[model samples]
Target: FCFKILNFPAEHIMHMAIGTSLSIILVTVTNSMYAHHLNKNIDWNISKKMFFAIVIGALAGGFVSKDLAAKTLEIIFSVYVTLVSIKMLMDVKVERDPKATKDVFYWTVGFIIGFKSTILGIGGGTISIPFLTWRGLPMKKAVGISASLGIPIAMAGVASYIYNGMKISNLPEYSMGYIYLPALVGVVLTSSFFARIGAKLSHNLDQQKLKKAFAIFLMLIALKIFIG
Candidate 1:
């Protein structure tokens, strides 16, 4: 939205790299505390193992994105976003088996999700939840674990962007490398307040309908970006 409509002056990848980290930080802080208080079921063993790899992958992703051309990065990101939106619309049913997997497999999954999270500017939930549930975790547990992983991923992503953009010249005012402070503030303030409301409504609303609507919105955003 910022890049296509508001004409943000920074590279699209840079804006996403910064915005995603900041938003994840705020959302994770609020949601993690809430989930912990409520004892939201989580697979701590897998989560612990994945955390290390996820962090490393996030850092690597940020650095990798920094080196890509703006137009190339934008095209890749738009395609990925479009696919994720389509996945949401599909909303296929998944069963939980609660089986075991090799450490190597878990680490691989963690790294892949983490790497994509940074490039796509997400908290990894979209990919993580499906992967976890497919691997025998309950839906609720998968979501909780995904939320927990966001902390490390966000930290690594922010640090990498800060380091990579530190010496870049001609950034706009109130910018920390790729991070635009004013944009971050606006997003955090609005999302933090509305997120709780959305959660509440989710319990009462038709979830499938909501997901479809959100997916349509994302598709539109992707199309807008692709055409510009």
Candidate 2:
């Protein structure tokens, strides 16, 4: 929404992003449940570990983001999203029944991902999937776990953006804090169904093929954001 769909300023766009994130919970939940029932590979334990850290990080990021320069935030966002592209391009092997690294390691990763995700108004999958894979999770399970953890990021972003945006008196119409009602409604109506399809495809396809596709997709997004 930089220069393409909308022309809102960075901070305001972040609020819009947080609002859009609210619908992602549906997609993530659907993804997790399907993965658990059909694939039997959902990592609820690691998801639990990441939840607390993400909430705290997202809450803090809302405030910290206001102090950051837009250009700086853009650079940070571009750099991290691109990590997924690079990691996937490398074709890293997926570990079977891999044990999660350590609590401290995940906690650290969770916080950083949460902070950046909130500030950038992202869903966190780009960071979450890559991190999970880096620590040995198979691609399918990594996608499920990443989707599971998206709930906390969305919840925290919604609350944070709502709270932070309340103090500003100059926001546009049909607005609650920073979230635009029209966009939220539109996203909520459609994102879940597509997300479910995406989850299903992730399971049915060859992971190597998935990696190549996902890598290219992320690269395009990073370039788009960076160019804007």
Candidate 3:
């Protein structure tokens, strides 16, 4: 009985790691395609910076304990993200202005995205998209940038989880900290193909519609976290 219970956490960690990694790949590919066809003017520098920032934040968040404090933080982040999504949903049109996006804003947002990604086990692109679109980036650009940003977030989060798991005593077999590799694999496999599809679809849909759909999705996820 003790052995069985101990094995449970390992299984969960495997699942999470696999799910998140695949999610990162799928989202990245989707965003790349969307940006290519929809937004001709791509700023690779900004995308790179956002990606690193997300990684750092995710690493930090992943190492933290999953205790009350962590849970509280997660709740706060979920509420904040949900509100932002709702606000974006209310806006019918996104004003596009490349000049309006500042370096400071990107970094700040990247940090938030990274932290959220690690704690929530989600791609920061979900939040980054709305914020970037509101700041004047085209939806395509925002999605692309957000998708790029997820790479670092996943890398950092996964690494940290593995590191932490190694240090802790009595971890289950196949355990790698907070991540569940098996679930991670499952999610990644399923989501990657769909993410590519999503990216392709983004080209056919208007920015407003995409924003609305994304916002609703974010809200639902946030709600689930809150309930959990």
Choose the strongest candidate by TM-score: 1
Return the lDDT, model 1, position 26: 44
Predicted structure 1, TM vs. truth: 0.86
lDDT of 2 by residue, 1-228 (tens): 632256665556645554455544534555555655466667788889998998888778877876666577667767876986887798657465555487988898899878877887776777787778777787767777877777788778777777777887766677788677777667656765666676677667887887788789989988987777
> Candidate 1: minimum summed lDDT over ten consecutive residues — where?
28-37
TM-score for each of the candidates: 0.86, 0.82, 0.72
- Candidate 1 lDDT (Cα, whole model)? 0.72
Candidate 3 residue lDDT tens string, 1-228: 122344454334333433345345544455454545465534577787676666677766776534325346556667867987888788767466656566777778888888776766666766787687677777777777766666677677667666665665655454455444554566566766676677666678776776788789889868876775
Q: Alpha carbon lDDT of residue 96, candidate 3?
A: 61
Candidate 1 lDDT over 126-186, as tens digits, reads 7887888888876667766776787778778777776766777766667686776676777
Q: Name the lDDT value of residue 109 in candidate 2.
A: 87
For model 3, what is the alpha-carbon lDDT of residue 37?
40
Over 4 Å off, model 3: 1-42, 65-74, 100-102, 168-173, 222-228
Report the alpha-carbon TM-score of model 3 versus the true structure: 0.72
